[model samples]
Target: MPRQSAGILLYRKTNNELEVLLVHPGGPFFVKKDLGSWTIPKGEYDDSEEALAAAQREFEEEIGSPVTGTFLPLGTIRQKGGKVIQAWAVEGDLDADAIVSNTFELAWPPKSGKVETYPEVDKAVWFSVAEAKTRINEKQAELIDRLVALVV
Candidate 1:
């Protein structure tokens, strides 16, 4: 079965520009990751859980702060990796520094007995849609386009 994830795409209008919030993945694996590495604040969920609630939970977990707003469903999209992600566009913005991501443990090097903890999302930032296209993953860029269409 394909993996399923859900998240909210947050956008805010600043200085006449629409900015979208995107997160950078954490850990050594993503150390040099930049383009195509940024992603929505999202995570996988099981069939036993509700999609919207899971989105809210994952958003909170990844970004570290609570977010509440009217969710405008952007529908589901299958990423290049075949992960089906459900997203909603909400009309609120958060300070990137407010993010308090949860941690995960992973062996830094394969076969190394040492383990290290890393934030699931190292940091988040707001970028203009034009700039966001460059920061967001290739497949996930569709959300930014769709969301712009919705709000504009």
Candidate 2:
């Protein structure tokens, strides 16, 4: 079976414009990449776990803060690689600069026999719906569109 993930889409309004939080993946492979590399803070989950609970857990794990609000289901989408992501939109605000992501170890430089630690998410930023469309992964852009229609 394909992998399944769950996540929360944090959204807030500023100056009458709707903005959503997007996170950049950490580590070397994503360092030089920008546009189309940002994504909602998410992580894989197994079938035994409740999707909403898993989404909240992943959000806190990836963003270093807890999220609590009425979640509007943004539904699910399958990425090009076939991983399915289920997401929810919540009206909330967080300081992007204050994010503290959890770390993961990876064998760096391919077979160098050394492990390096990197954050699951290096940074997060708030982007307008339009800007988010350009910054987020193509498959996940549907989440933004769903959010805009519901909130804007």
Candidate 3:
């Protein structure tokens, strides 16, 4: 079976404009990537676990704070690699500049013997729906459309 991941897309309204929270990945591979590199705070899950619970867990893991709100299901999308992502839209807010993400160790320079530690998410930002569509993974952009249909 293909890998399955779950995540929560946090959104809030300010100045009568809707904004969604998106996270930029850390590590050298993504260091220079900007557009089409951001994504919902998400992680993988298996058959034994529930998708919603995993989404909540991943959100807290990546954002360093637990999230609770009325979760509006945005359904699923398949990425270019065939990994499936299940996402939900929740009305909420978070301090983009103050986020603290969990860390992971990766072997740097490919076959080099050096290892480096990096945060799972280097930064988080809230963007208007129009802007988020450009920042988030292209395949996952559909989640934004679903959110607009459900709440706008």
Candidate 4:
């Protein structure tokens, strides 16, 4: 079975323009990458766990804040690598600069005997739907499109 993940697409409207929050992955592999490297704050979950609850947990783990409100289901999308992502759209706002992401330890420098700690999400930004399309993974862009269709 393909891996399943869940996430929340946090969005806000400013002066009638809609914007979504996208997070940049941390660690050496993504340090220099930009376009197509951003994504909704998500993580893998087991079948025994509820997707929506897992999505909320992952959001708090990655964004350092708990999200509460009505969630508009954006449904699911299969990524190129066969990871299916279940997402929801929530109307919310947060300080992009104040995000405190959880950290992961990985062996850096290839064979270096040292493990380094890095934030799961290096940073987050609010982008207009058009801008998010360019920054987010191509497959995940569908979530943004779904949100646009619902809100606009």
The 10-residue segment with the lowest total lDDT in model 2: 143-152
Over 1-152, each residue of candidate 4 has an lDDT whose tens digit, in order, gives 99999999999999999999999999999999999999999999998999999999999999999999999999999999999999999999999999999999998887998999999999999999999999999999999999999989
Query: What would the per-residue lDDT of candidate 1 be over residues 54-112, giving only the tens digit for each residue?
Result: 99999999987777989999988899889999998888877898789999999878789
Measure candidate 3: CA RMSD. Answer: 0.6
Q: Which segments of candidate 3 are over 4 A away from where they belong?
A: none
Predicted candidate 4, C-alpha RMSD? 0.5
Better of 1 and 3 by TM-score: 3
Per-candidate TM equals 0.97, 0.98, 0.98, 0.99
Off by over 4 Å in 2: none
Model 1: lDDT equals: 0.91
In angstroms, give how far residue 140 of model 2 lies from its true place: 0.3
Higher-lDDT candidate among 1 and 2?
2
The alpha-carbon lDDT assigned to residue 10 of candidate 4 equals 97
Give a tens-digit lDDT track for model 3, residues 42-66.
Answer: 9999999999999999999999999
Candidate 4 is scored at a TM of 0.99
Candidate 1 — which residues are off by over 4 angstroms? none
lDDT of 2 at 77: 95
Which structure is stronger by lDDT: 3 or 4? Answer: 4
